[model samples]
Target: MAEFTVNATRFDPYKNFKFRVKWDGKYVAGISKVTSLKRTTEVVKHRHGGDPSTSRKSPGRTEFEAVTLSRGVTHDVEFERWANKVWNYGSGLGAETSLKDFRKDIIIEVYNEAGQLAQAYKVFRCWVSEFESLPELDANANAVAIQTIKLENEGWERDYSVAEPTEPSFVEP
Candidate 1:
């Protein structure tokens, strides 16, 4: 077992802008934004016959929320390739969706301002539930073209093995 150490000098939290998403042991490029990871559990309310007028609450099934990832549209086909695993457009009647090797495990890594890996999360059994290849094109608009993918995952947990790194201090010359 690895010992955990605290970085006492880190007064501020990690910034959200320095992060990356990886799958298949490789990083996906140009990921501009990612939705927050969330989960909800249902509460089961039950009452006993002997109880006067109060009901008891118990934990029920927990469901993980879908995460959406957005990136600038480019020639990279990573988004479209993963989306096709769910449902292909022109592939035959019954062979549209590829059942085997469809779901994948992904990692979201957060980096500190100094470009050090601060934290990471492992998302399990993720598959693209929704995908947007291209946003509405407007020649008049100056915004960049963007593509998105909504990933439905079974669950996600923090990777505790990634210990907090000791922040570096620089002296001015």
Candidate 2:
């Protein structure tokens, strides 16, 4: 495990645009957007018989929010293939779902301005819950065709192995 180090020179936070999503040890191509990672814990309230009105609260189950990834429609079928693993249409009655390898662990990496990997997260047991292969098309409208996939993951954790990077510096004479 890499020890955490603070980069005092880096005043500005990392830009959201410089990030990448990878699965199966390979980075997915052309991923334009990724929803924020979030988790919520259920609050459980309990009150004793003699206790006053207010109930004591405690944390219960925690759920990881679904993450949506969007990109311009292209020849790349990584999103479509993962979505199909959950439910494939026209693939016959008993063969609709690929149970053996449906879920995948994915990595989301954020890079600093100098293109150095600054942070990384490991999302576990993710399976596509929804997929949109193509947006509505119109001859009069001009826009890139976008596709999307919503992934439901069991949990995620920050990869502490990725230490803080040393920001690059330029010298001026």
Candidate 3:
């Protein structure tokens, strides 16, 4: 993302002025009009939306609102892509850790198609060993661990099978 800085000054009609405005890009002289000095000053101040420390909500919210309102469709598409990527990754990882005595906090960093860090989500998986009723290192624990391994392996098989579908139904009958 490009860093945007705002530069504002009194519109001098007599003297030629040139300055780059935020988001609007480069602007040259005679582009902006200054009808009344007092009125223009009032309008500029109003546009600035008063002091930052004031109770009034910050202009950042306005900037976000403007961007979101303008790029609603883009935002939705980006969100869907992000969600799909996260789900695909999670599906792979979820099978591996399920029913095992793994850590509760698993952080997954999701990236956009442009390879930018979009967002992060936490995955919490339950373990049979963590349960009070299950005996430690007993048949039940071993069974659960075996189940987890099977699940993980099965997930990988499913992914590969989907990538190279050999079944008659998948051949488009």
lDDT of 2 by residue, 100-135 (tens): 999999999999889999999999999999999999
lDDT by residue for model 3 (10-101), tens: 13222222211111122211212211101111112233456565443323211100001011121123223322332333566555332333
**Better model by TM-score: candidate 1 vs candidate 3:** 1
> Who wins the lDDT comparison?
1
| Cα distance off (Å), candidate 3, residue 13 | 47
Instruction: Give the CA lDDT, 0 to 100, for residue 49 in model 3.
Output: 52
Q: TM-score of model 3 relative to the true fold? A: 0.16
lDDT of 1 by residue, 58-167 (tens): 99999999999999999999999999999999999998999997899999999999999999999999999999999999989999999999999999999989989888
Descending-lDDT candidate ranking: 1, 2, 3
Clashing pairs in 1: none
For model 3, give the 10-residue run with minimal summed lDDT.
149-158
Estimate candidate 1's RMSD in Å: 1.2
Q: Estimate TM-scores for all models.
A: 0.96, 0.95, 0.16
TM accuracy, model 1 = 0.96
Descending-TM-score candidate ranking:
1, 2, 3
